[model samples]
Target: MTEFADNVRQAAVAMRALFPATPMQRNAHLSAKYDADIWLKREDLSPVRSYKLRGAFNAMSKRIAENPDQQLFVCASAGNHAQGVAFVCNRLDRKGVIFMPVTTPQQKIDKTKVFGGEHIEVRLVGDYFDDCLRAAQEFCAAEGGQFLPPFDDPDVIEGQATVTMEILDQMPRVPDRIILPVGGGGLSAGARAYLNALNADVHLNFVEPKGGASLTAALEAREPVTLNKVDTFVDGAAVARIGANTFSVLSDTAPQDVLLATEDGVCTTILEMLNIEGIVLEPAGALSIKVLDDLRDEIRGQTVVCVSSGGNFDFERLPEVKERAQRYLGLKKYFILRLPQRPGALKDFLGMLGPDDDIARFEYLKKSARNFGSVLIGIETKSASNFERLFGLMEEAGFVFNDITDDETLVNFVI
Candidate 1:
């Protein structure tokens, strides 16, 4: 344990040449809301706007120190990891070949190029990440270049532990609990390793996106397993499988300590942080904060730290984030309505809505019959109970409708 702690401290000190430690900030708004001493490890403020660069830099720096001849680095990533590697490659003066899926957004691609500058090359490969990863591994082997894994490596884990090092140093006293966002588990694993080594009495909470609870799945199975499906909305942490190396460190995590935040729930947190707190957090960055509602009772009066992992949110997705958040809060809904073909029927149905209710979308799916037609409608209201009152009135008036807001399949196709 002492040896591991020493290694982490040494790694953190070595990182000073590249960049200083990220800040740990106490959030007054969250502290007041949760009745706890809420602190945020602002990894979102890092040079790459994420903690990923820590692992990437640690892995690359150590690799070169051990083998000076290793001049070329390779990695496959569509988002933060790619940018991390690019930044590190340029800083370390090493050649980097980054493979990204062809479908990756141009914004991310351009960011990677800007960070790497003349030190790296970008290759757009298959439409999926897995395909790009295979191509990168093959190319690395063929060219005899070292492949830098985003996570799942010893040096990377050591690098990520530096985050915990900074948190402990910045805080006036040891926190009662630390809340971490889990993706492929590198950050959590590293933090867990460091805390366990010191025999800290701190409680740990692991937050995962509900759609990609790979860490929960791994803990249940006692090993890493690939999920059959994953929701990519929280792309930063939407991993299909927990890394095997990381699982070894996190295997003993209690099920209760692993909280799952729904995609809509995360969006709600993102919006709240943006609108109320003036903080822009990416979906994955909001996971730890989103789970605070679940810990409202447990965390009261306790000093807790929530890691805001990244702030690489694209403003173009704001409308979608607002939409999901509205749906989650029950302020918005989509439904299929059976409206009478008669002209007065349309006017009467519109009148049925409460004053607070406003129509956002109205489209005809198809005229099912001469007397009746199916219309897709989206409504935004001030309160959730308004929907219940609105539905009751519709039933009484014989205005048939089906709420498709919660129907995933129907939403994917029609809404």
Candidate 2:
């Protein structure tokens, strides 16, 4: 084996002191649905509920080994990374400083604290991740502490490569293909490096959230380029820019090998996995699985492994996830309708509804109009065709309405 592969194996062995290898379970539902042998590398089942702990532990351990005098470690993260570093610090009894954006959820902050116990200190920094990162770096430099990057460092990449080693060891045979979810590219880069070093012939595919496709952009540009805006719905994988070190390893990747999953579509997969398989997946965790439908033809009858990256989903977001999934499936809609201001108008509108159509929201926006009033209405139904039938009846009855489900600005303000 190549030196890199040997190092990755060593890292994996060292990791046993902290936690056992994460499960590599074959998902029967996915296998039957795709007509292929499908397995999941359940990183979401890790101690911190993410693969992040591997990288953090490896990097910190190597750094301290290189210099035993080093005691202070610093990092900036609003989610998994912070928890990973905290867990490691607590386990090692090392001092750590964690910086998170001021807007981070209380649950995340609490989890980080719980993992670190007395070994780490949590600081609420700026309002944005970039700002928080800057603060962490400045503080680390000032205090002479070791700053742990989320995904860009060589040590961290080496640490994450352990996942690839564990997969090859646990699987009955080498998979025909491996699907990995990309964020800043740590996991993908590490896996790619390990496979290349081992001379493995596994076909690798990458999936990224459509709103924050940094890896796709980097591959296309031949370098890392920051996105102008990123949707935070898939918060775990929504990186504005791919890491520079990671891009070096992933630079030769073909654009065709990278797939994009819509945020709403990921929500659908999240709900499906939760309700059907009793599995909870955060938006980022569901990315690789969400792209399975797109690769059905290529992966049919072949063995495949998908990395479910994290399961730090807050139950508070379940309603929003359900709403987005329903909208993506065309089973829910919001519209503005102009109704005549007369007696029995409400009864007439209710009469136009199909048996499956239920009014989820109804509010008059302009009740003082003399002839007509503008009403904002949300409807839920069993099928998309129900909307068509309901709209047809509304039009025949002389109702004026505009579907606002796809209107981003209006929905943000009113919905």
Per residue, candidate 2 scores C-alpha lDDT tens digits across 33-67 of 99999999999999999999999999999999999
TM-score of each: 0.99, 0.99
- Count of backbone clashes, every candidate in sequence: 0, 0
Which regions in candidate 1 have their CA more than 4 angstroms from the true location?
Answer: none
Candidate 2 CA-lDDT value: 0.95
Worst 10-residue lDDT window for candidate 1 reads 14-23
Q: Tell me the tens digit of each residue's lDDT in model 1 across 253-309.
A: 999999999999899999999988899899999999999999999999999999999
Q: What local distance difference test score does each model get?
A: 0.94, 0.95
- Candidate 1 TM-score over all chains jointly: 0.99
**Over all chains combined, what TM-score does candidate 2 have?**
0.99
Model 2 residue 166 lDDT?
89
